[model samples]
Target chain A: MTETTGTNTRVICPKCRQELPWFALNTDTMSLCTQCGSAIRACVFPALLHTHQPDPDLPVPVAEGDASCFHHAGRKAVAACEECGRFLCALCRINRMGRNVCAACLSRQKHDGALPNLTTERILYQQIAWTLTLLPLLVFPFLAITAPIAFGYAIHAIRQPPGILPQRRWPMILAALLALAEFALGLWIIHLMLDDMA
Target chain B: MTAESPSYQPFGRSTLESSLAYRIRHRLFTGPDHLLLVRQEGYRETYRRLYFRDIQAVIVRRTVWNRIYAAWLGTFTLAILLLAAVLAVKQSPPPAALIVFLIAWIPGLGLLINAHRGPTCDTWIQSAVQSLPLKPLNRLPLANRFIAAVRQPVESAQGTLNPAALQAFATDSAAPSGRGPETSSTPATDTATIPVLPFRPYRGHAHTVLFALLLVDLAHSLFRFHSTAPVMLITGLILSIALLTSLILALSRQAGTRLPNTIQGLTWTTLVYLVLAYSFHSSLMMFRLPTWNHSSPASLLQVLYPPAGTSMITTSFLVLSALMAGLTGSMGLVQLYRRQSGHPPPPPSPP
Candidate 1:
């Protein structure tokens, strides 16, 4: 676990992005940002044991027995990329998903959008499911089209991971079930109409 | 900071004062590093311990009703003073009128103090995922101190005091596969980047408008504007309907949103009360029930009690309307306050 000494802690203002001393936050009421004049409410949490430090992309020494970085030949290598076996300097090495990788490999994964750790934009399947399942109810006939779609989306959501925040899976499940029921009801209505026409 | 420390210092204490029972139901103990929330419920004691490091945020929210109440009290005081002045100008002022003026000062003074103290805010501590509410703190100072105590260790532990170093550290440790480093990010930022929390914009505007209408209607009644009763009734009915519709829209728009149970209860109660009051008042007015002289009471007894000539039904409707107006007005004030307080709405329930 990484630990930083707490003697010099500062919080970034959400509004202005100005770094404010932790003590400057008013916990009782909304604190005004000196820079932006925006009201802020600070929710203080326990500090993480580990602190992140930036690595300087320095030139590698030409001395014998010194390993050079795979990406930057001039930089001294600190560790080998766990993913691709490439020697990486402190600046080129990226720790993610419990493994260290070189800049090239990290960039490749991000470009491909294959790595969950690199994912910033997410499809909110729950919102989609909710919109499909409930919104169609306003126009009762639209349920015939939307219900199946809602069910399909809800089922699809199960295989995918939830958003960055923790959430229960029950809503999706319930939505899927309700959509299925609506779809079935629509089908039954269609069958009844056919029988009446016959 | 450890749990076993004999010198555990508490920054705040919440005691449930029950006259009928000698039971200590809720107690909050804060140490240098941890907060312990204890609840005792009839032979069962439950304890929840939260370390300062794990707490993500402490949310303190206050409703506007307290300020509204204070304003109402101030108006009441002023009205009493004006009435006293009017009485003094008379050839001989009644002793009862003087007594009423003197009696009003007690509540007026109490309300002024309450207003000066500010609203009793609801406090909640947000950890990683769950938010735990402390007993609602009444005094702003006490709430501030409690928050300071909880946040101090966390702030110190996080080492956020030195921004440059922390930023450097953050950049150095940035996961290459994750989002880009924020070390060079300037203070001037766009609001678009901020995550949009679940919120109902203009959520309480309908309620506020409805309350304002109710207040206007009350004033009309007090002034005995009989000819305008129909107009007030129609306006009240329309606003009440609008209020109900807006409330439904709010609920539907933010499905599975969790508000404090007390707030939900208050909202529902005020709605029901307003509906009943409106119905009764409108009915009585339509039937042309005799109106009382609220401004000029024949005696203190007449002022305190219902007039003898008025039917019991009329009296009841009048009284109920008055009570509901006050209750709903306060509720609306609270809703308005919450809307203005700048706290992000609670996160929607997960699907």
Candidate 2:
């Protein structure tokens, strides 16, 4: 286990869905859930199987997601903590973002925090629509930059789509591939046009 | 094309084969064994679009030249002999016998032509009837059907049996043994079958022995007038009939291919016919009664062989010849009738 950065705390059991007491577990310190007695992992929520509550303080996990060095907390905030509205010091928290959050407020946050976004499908659709319109007209170089950028914000706009929606991912992926082919052909057309001009 | 697509498809292989079989049963023409009948998807349509319109298809195979020649041989001999007899009897010398011989060519060529794109010929009737369902024909006596099946092919061939099968019968008594007892119980037993001694119900060789009877009649003619020329011709005709019948059976079957072709058999038969007929003419005159011997060669000829007796003799020869040929013709036709009519044994009691 890493040294306690006062921000670390314990949270509920995702498997049994039980609320747990503080200090009951740590990254290396093993224990069980007080309510259900399920073996508890000291690892923060997303890192382990089963989902815990989303962070109330930070924006929902963004596209630029990673182990963040929280300057105020001193512990690396690998996941956003869901409890108190602050990036906290290690000893003051419990596990969040699969890391320990400060001991206090883990249960309060588990009940109150909002969840991660689910709009990947909407983003995927909008990007496909954008590319289909743009790629045919010799505009791929411009389309590539704008579509992927907008794709990010669009993906974050809603909660995660029902897991079932991934079935539609294949056709969209196929569309994306066709778009790539069209982009290449479009470039070839432009090259020919330039050759004719010269 | 669009309608043909299966909305729901069968998943098994045999199911597909059964479907194809069902299609064939509904669509294809089936017929007696000799004229090759084949069922295929595109061919029937192709034929319909061509040589014939009403028929789905028509296939033709011409009679082999030798069979045609044999047919001509029978018809020519019968016609010429009859014409000569008629002229002599009428006391008017009509056209020469050679012209009559030439005229006989029509029967050999014309048996089938009489039907003329129509269905009067029993060959077509029998052929077509063989393929139809046996049920509707329930009114036909079982005996009739049996006789029809066995005799049909032979009857159609005139006196000739299928050469290959009959000769095999001559050489090997067991040659045609493999075909069932049912085939045996019907028709002029194809002498081509190899006799399976015990199982073969003794059918007297009544058909084949008719030749010997012809020879004896020729011999009686020789002793009566004792004319060498008449004796020779009579003997020749008798021997020719015997030899042609046997050898045609042999040669046509082409069974003893190692020995010779039908042409050789036919050639020898024809030579025998000519020689024996020549010998009979001279022998009959030479063997005439002693009292008829006269002074001059002309008187000697008349006295020895009186014109009335000669006419009677010629008429007798012509009648006998026609009778013999016609009888053989009926025998073959009857045999053919029996074959097509004969019922196969009730499906052998399941194992």
Candidate 3:
């Protein structure tokens, strides 16, 4: 797999890491690997043709009468941080999804998970709530203990981030209604049991 | 979100792998600038972003998971139908048999759906960072659509390379270079230029041991069926333990290694056999074992070994076990010999 990123944008066979012929790449037809003869279909994009350029990190020295960096007074300001409105030098500026942000603002976004791009993982509260409501139905008696908890969880899940793509509210709504019904049934059963005891 | 920020559209969704315990789902979302891979496992979701400008290639390799899934479902459905037929012949209630027949339809429908989806495949996206599987594109049709959607944006971002340039780069990459030919190189260019290293092929010591153990078990099964002596029971127990250890060793060792196709197939066959054998034997034990209490350690011995010369089910089970072991063990040894004798191995099977 690492061989795919070989010297001059070489497209290798996925199975064997053997370099594919130029004709094998970007073709609609199936191609066979030269070494391990595994059937392969590949689409080589233009990114393979163009090499990536690393951004320059060294800051330029500040000149007289020029706007200096907020973090480093001696360095020239290249861009303003999108979040904090602070002037940032080349080294201090972190270009993320076309936004020039300072290290501090970037770290803050990462910690707060305010930016979707910065979030590596998220908990799907809606799924957890749905599972809570549905799984207890197998043992009906447990519904008395779980119904209110499920309803509460569904309400709490609404304020959290749904998912990367917007989540549908219908499933959560259905779960809440079911929980309510289960709670009512549980209350009736408890009342009947208490009456018999009395 | 800024006005200039790219808007994303849903590309495709696929269950990458699933079992009884958990399932990992992959959903691809495409934006003008990049493609996002969101993987969901239980309540947690993780993200991987592959920029169009960084994506080098999209590769699709064929796999046999589709066929394997179909076979499993078909076998399960057949077994259920057979059981239902047996119950009907025994004059079981119509509703009882009907219920069993209806249950078979679940896996029957699953088999039909699996077949309809066409062949399975493993799709990978090679980027500047590392090559990772694009699980959402697990089928050829899905991969085709994904490639079509991604190609235009990527080409527009970085200009297309002509055949002549591609060929030149292929030749240049095959040999060696200081910096890449046409494109502006990065600091990592030097590392990418390193020659491809040779990989070691797997030596099948575990496989040999497993085959040998299977043959030993086959012989032991026949011997234990003829004699009811205490020594025979002890020997049977020891053989069972050894066979189980070898099975585990062989299965684990073959994973991620380039083993011959014949050996791989044999390993899988043995796995299927073991699972079936265990299920049947455990059910039989539960049905026949007299004492359920833990207080009687002596009666528990009957659960381990079906009483010899007692029942038709025990005799038939032992016979079936011996037959399977003998056939598989012989086949394994022949395949191993063919491999050692310089015969060309068959095409590699998908894991």
Candidate 4:
């Protein structure tokens, strides 16, 4: 992802290396290369690419009177971790989730999946409700148990926001209805048998 | 620094042109010392300028629209093939239908392959207090060069040597000057703090396998492999279990994350219901049970109840499976629609 910056800052077609016109560069849109006919996006001009400088990250040499990093005794302390109050050298000071954290705190947060910025996994309750409501219908009898559960889940899901993609509530509604109907039908059959026995 | 100097280069442009889509055009201008961003709408224009020293971070994030577009295109093409196959079986089989089906696959494969190539990225320049999103660029090399150009002046202005310069200096001096004396004992980079997660594609391995199994099932059903019903049933049962496990895993992993659970449930339910419905239907067919025909029924009772000589258990299973199949199918379609529209999933609650 990192590349060396040359003195020339012209936006060039990656395929052809020909300098792109001002119109192509400023429009921030994809255009066909004049020579190669390959589609190219002009937003990637040479001037914008950069590798983070190593100086800011380099650990300062510790002197007799200077405060040292908590973890590195030979390095000067640059910043304090916002969460743990640990002294950190330039290399140890991590900017994560808009906070300056030490390596330990960042590691702990990531391990716990507590960092809001990093989402590793998610649980979708609506899918469970939908599955419960509809999947057991094949067995017929299982619907008697699952229908009420599905209906209750649908109501619960309505109050909660959906996952990474929004989903309509109609499927849950349909599942609830179908489950209810199956339950009612089962009860009706039981009542008929009881009446005949009496 | 003056207007007449070659350093004052025009890097971006703003436009007042508005199509039916009402897209707002913005312009960027770059100089040796400063970068200016301008937004023009109709007769009014607003501008902001950032000095080289004040710029903090330049980030380029890849968008998922290309993958979505490719998936949609592939799905559409597959659907056309499915329609052709269904028509060929339901009516007089035509050689032209097979040709159309085979030809439709070429575009479908191309779209999927294109999607696998990844997306063009959107670039943003961030200062301490504000972030400005540059126009999206698809060319990786050009984008990298653009970042490097912006970085060079900013690093120079801040009195910090660029990475290339530092690397060159280190190579020439034959000594590690940046890292302190205790660098040998400590790791060069904090791997734990890197925040790299395992890559999980939208359609995972289980999904691909399930799709393949369904296709095979469909082909078998179309070709009338009645003797292979048991084999189909066993395969379907395995698929059902696999699907159930994947669904549970997916749900548990996302439990605390803010996501619309309904679609996940709908997709799982649809797949499970399809598997269950097909299994039950096949079982009934294997047993030679009389299928209930609503159109030929004499009354409502006949429609609701099994006809004479038909097993009540088999009839109930058939009816329930059909009902579930219809419900789950519609639900899955709704979920697909919501996803395609780019509705934001619910945000995760703080732990």
Reference contact recovery of candidate 1: 0.15
TM-score, predicted candidate 1 vs. hidden true structure: 0.41
Which of 2 and 3 is ahead in lDDT? 3
In order, the Cα lDDT scores of the candidates are 0.56, 0.36, 0.75, 0.52
Model 4 chain A — which ten-residue stretch has the worst lDDT? A1-10
TM-score of chain B of each: 0.51, 0.25, 0.67, 0.38
Query: In angstroms, how far off is B209's CA in candidate 1?
Result: 6.5
Clashing pairs in 3: none
Most TM-score-accurate candidate: 3
lDDT at position A198, candidate 2: 100
TM-scores, chain A, per candidate: 0.59, 0.28, 0.77, 0.51
lDDT of 2 by residue, A136-173 (tens): 34655454444443344234322223221222444444
lDDT of model 1 at position A125: 75
Q: Candidate 2: list runs displaced more than 4 Å.
A: A1-198, B1-75, B78-102, B108-200, B203-211, B221-309, B312-316, B319-351
lDDT of 3 by residue, B1-351 (tens): 332334568886656678898889888888667888888888898987888878888888776567556656766687677667866887878998899899999999999988877777778888765787887777777788778878888888877868777776666555545435465354434434446654345577788888988898789878876776667778777877887888898888776555654577677877888788889988887786764556565546655575655764676567667777777787788878877686454444547
Give per-residue CA lDDT, model 1, range B14-114, as digits (tens).
55745666654566766556676666554344656677666655655444446545654655575566556545665345885687579679768978787
**Top model by lDDT, which number?**
3
Candidate 4, residue A120: the lDDT equals 28
Cα lDDT for residue B173, candidate 4: 27
Ranking by TM-score: 3, 1, 4, 2
Residue-level lDDT of model 1, residues A1-198, one tens digit each, is 011122222344432345443444444457655443334455544342132444455555535778988877877888898768988877777776557887777777655545533343456677688888888877765577889899988998776653322458998899999999888877777788789999
